[model samples]
Target: MTSTTTTPGGPALELDDIQAGALMPRPNPYAGAFWGLRIDDRHAGRELLRRLIPLLKPASSFDPERPVSLGLSLTFTGLRALGVPQESLATFPAEFQQGMAARAAELGDAGENAPEHWDKPLGSADLHVVVAVLARDTVLMESLITLAGDALRDIPGVVPVWYLDVHVPADGREQFGFKDSISEPAIEGTGILGSNPHEASLKAGEFILGYEDETGAVAPLPQPDVLGRNGTYVAFRKLHQRVAAFRQYLQQSAADRAEQEWLAAKMVGRWPSGAPLAVAPDKDDPELATDPTRNNAFLYGDDPQGLKCPLGSHARRMNARDSRINGDVRLHRMIRRGTNYGPSLPSGVTEDDGADRGLMFAFVGAHLGRQFEFVQREWVNDGSFIGTDEKDPLVGANEEGRFTIPNRPIRRRLKALPSFVVNRGGEYCFAPGLQALRWLAELDT
Candidate 1:
């Protein structure tokens, strides 16, 4: 008995109790696979969530002949390995109970991106249950990973340690070629709109749990309210990408190859065909980057001196829309999603092909500390609110980074700037809803 809709003014979501990859989008030549699961036993993790709730599918059963979906999340030690109550895990949110590897120095994730150099049951607690799946390729993502490996055949302790497999490359571009998951946010009642039609929507409890957000209140749940109403919190990660040190640091900071593709489109304010250097600032237009209403319709408050983008660009330090930062870009909006893993680097190869490619990011929200750890500690690892202490010159954590670029007859800094994305680990999930996965498979524990 789960159903709700209401949008004319907001608050009523329950799109059949959410989770269709937390608000559907990501099916453009897809094929995914995440899996993690551990749950040593609590009745085999409630019989692997009652055989994955009849192969989960909601968010009003998305479409395109199912385009293949499936999602599920957990951790907070998989809700205390499925037993759940320590006062309902003390009502969740301490940045999702100190997860994401105890907030890795608040997400700059230090030299060689820490968490003791991750990638082992990713930031473990034996990594309890993630299981994603997507599709539209790899033969329907291996027939939904063989029906999620036949619901972990013979469950027992429920292991399946880890797995990755992400995709999207029919020229969708992301092992740093760019065009990644354009922009996302618009949540209100989730008719899913925001690719920036001047951005408004937000408030569906800032992304699902219970309701009313954008601070008109209600953004804290996770107790008996049927296991946190229509849950949502996810984070995910697993980055990596260094595609031959980002194409030999854009061929030693440009002078050829069309100024190294305009210095990788001013450090990614977009145009490996996702357009937008505040709307095609003089180049790569692939027809306005495949025009979806003028590709994320421009606005850095009309380029505030960053000469069409670069206010420490990485999509304008991730959504600084009307520019002027130092907080409140719609209270740090998030919903991001990405996918691309292994094998891509061969176009005029800059070298390092010991390939273990990148990006499997994800975020969804309900305020994991004001939206994904405040956009990974203030817009992708700090740049002094765009004044520059320098980071996010394309996935920060750099050691010798410095990147200004406002230019016309002057500003083009870029010195050194290494660390082309690494941190191969991450987590801080929750996802529930679908009647909170049938109240976590009728938790009688």
Candidate 2:
């Protein structure tokens, strides 16, 4: 294998060796499935990768006509199961080695969101390989699923542990009725542009290993060049959204339907149509929401007071975007992609329906600690940066929480905000480069 090196002008990324799902955004109106597998035998696990190589698509070969795609990632335990040398294993980052469950408390996954309460095989070491299949519709999605199933059928020691189907609703709104997947950061060599024009392209190393990052430093690769060069860390989370509870909170806090919508937008920093409150603060502009050029093109410099978009809103806290925060916003940026699972709660309903519905969130980047975990801890679960003790209004663990909306006469504050999103379970895995997959398949040990 050839070693990846940087030049005076930044190295051109090995897109052919990079997984498509790790960089490109999913197609809208997409249907997908997530599968967790346990590697009981090292030989079988290696064989699994051999059969999966042709099915996986590279970042540079995306075709609109062939919309189906597949991605593969392995947990730390999975690498060990495949007989990875102890020396190579020690080179991975601490967060990736410890896994998500071990860092629960630091990530605000306490109370009902603890790891012990997580779904089976999710927080456990039994989970080794993660397979994600996605396509434009169910017909295409099922075709790939069948192909993936065939690869695992005759393998003796590769057992299917868990599975979840995901899709975008007809209205393109998440369970809480908000347009999701609206924002993403641009990478220097990928050619994919950022949603916000005001934002500059981040260095490739920020998201891919073996390249220079925002701080002008290349992140430490896992080991032996070939296995870790084009690889990236992925944080997979299953967040259960309490739609009834979310709706009830807005209904009780507001005076009318219009007021309810306004209050919801304040909490989210965007109208239901995917329009940012920074651009359309007074009302929900459907046209602006649909316009790709202007929907996510605003900044927080003018609204430092949080009048248009609350400083603590989910969107602002996640991105910050020129906001006077304690750190560089670009350094903490990562590619976030999500798909809705389970049925949506019917409109005008404010009662618990006992259906498990939420988002299967995936965070992709090279620096997992600084990019993903930092945002979850400081921005989502804590508010000290914005001079408050409140968590994110929509997704944080908000037991008896309060959100303040800055105004001229007096800031109207909403009290007793409940935790609408619960941490069902999650994992820390490494999506190796295409060459690394072949290396693992031919491992002698």
Candidate 3:
């Protein structure tokens, strides 16, 4: 598709106009809520957007000054239900229309997390829109949801079909005891220090529309340019972690306390403290993990042979750093922000609690097919790039899977690892810019 730079000489990101959740996540949100909306009436949905637009928080508005934030995104069905023209809708990425499950094989979601097992609200016929609310604590977040729900109650067409609450422990670990959301791609325009210093910054258009991307060319946009410019797509997923199973595997695979810790780090490519194996291969470095400036400074170029950090590791597979040979890694970058849900299983407990707990995964990008889906299919679920057929050790479908750890005497392979993470539900939506939202609200339809 032919394209032209929309922002041109202007700044790539107008932080004040973009949704807060699209750029950065609220630090330590005590409680978060996601609302799955289905538009039953067209005009009423637009009316709701008209009123809700005033309450949406912009990315620049996030700071110590304001502790609560709310974000809104709409799916292809949501847009169409609100009376968006067919010609205009045709401009969206093709994969977004097919939905995430259409490419299940590439994504390796065919097992437990397959679409058939997904929550009814996610990727369902009724799922049309999504609203994400963030707050400093559970009480405040609930209050906001109540107020928003009350306001929407009068709007006959739009109603919530599903909801979820998300949180992270004060220690910031996911259910599996890893420091989550630690590695992200730095968008050149935002200056967010997304990846480590060794990694180069990605073009802003890779994550946000209207700007030049890695190809030095602008990405294509929908018609009535005002409605499409500055908007980006989001992939939201509810991942359930099998905490009891993961702990049991670690116990049976390792010989001692130290070996158990080392084995876990090898599976994740980072110590539980968040220190990368490439930086602290032999031991955990709590100090380095906590250091904001140095934690992400190391690279994989020196360890090309996967001697320090295994090529098939979770982190290494997700971000190949200097190891990628076939394509420009910058083009495939995404802005990831997520929150953990469910209480941490008591330490040393290896039995199932059966409580629904896992990660609420959110990926923001301009190209859903190339950026988000490509990573899920190629990097996270397969190992051809790293010269092995192994999948991501921590989240991959572990059907007789084997994890290879390069060692001094000989490489150790952990076998028969079970799938530790399962997909509960998810959706693909469009996070529109302030102007696009205004356009939607004012549309004559």
TM-score, candidate 2, is 0.98
213-316 per-residue lDDT for model 2 (tens digits): 99998999999899999899999999999999998989898899999999999999999999999999999999999999999998999999999999999999
Task: Put down candidate 3 lDDT per residue, 1-445, tens digits, no spaces.
Answer: 2122224434546766677667764566367888888999889988889878888876666675457878889988898998998888898878877677665665778868789999887877688878888787878888889877876977877887988878866777888888877776766656465657777767778877877788887788877888887788999988989999999999899888799999999889999999999999999999998887877788888997788888888888777778854566777777887788777888889999888888999999998888888888888777777778888889887788888998878889999988888888787899998889999877776
Off by over 4 Å in 3: 1-12, 64-67
TM-score of each: 0.35, 0.98, 0.94
Per-residue lDDT over 71-93 for candidate 1, one digit per residue giving the tens place of the 0 to 100 score: 98988988898898798898888
Query: How many Å off is the CA of 9 in candidate 2?
Result: 3.4
- Lowest summed lDDT across 10 adjacent residues in model 1 is found at 2-11
Runs of candidate 1 with Cα error greater than 4 angstroms are: 1-35, 38-43, 47-128, 131-157, 161-204, 215-225, 235-242, 252-265, 268-305, 308-312, 315-317, 324-332, 335-350, 357-360, 367-406, 409-441
Error of 3 at 61 (Å): 2.9
Model 1 lDDT, residue 212, Cα: 78
RMSD of each: 18.4, 1.6, 3.2
At residue 439, what lDDT does model 3 achieve? 91
**Candidate 3, residue 266: how far the Cα is off, in Å:** 0.3
Minimal lDDT window, size 10, model 3 = 1-10
**Per lDDT, what order, best first?**
2, 1, 3
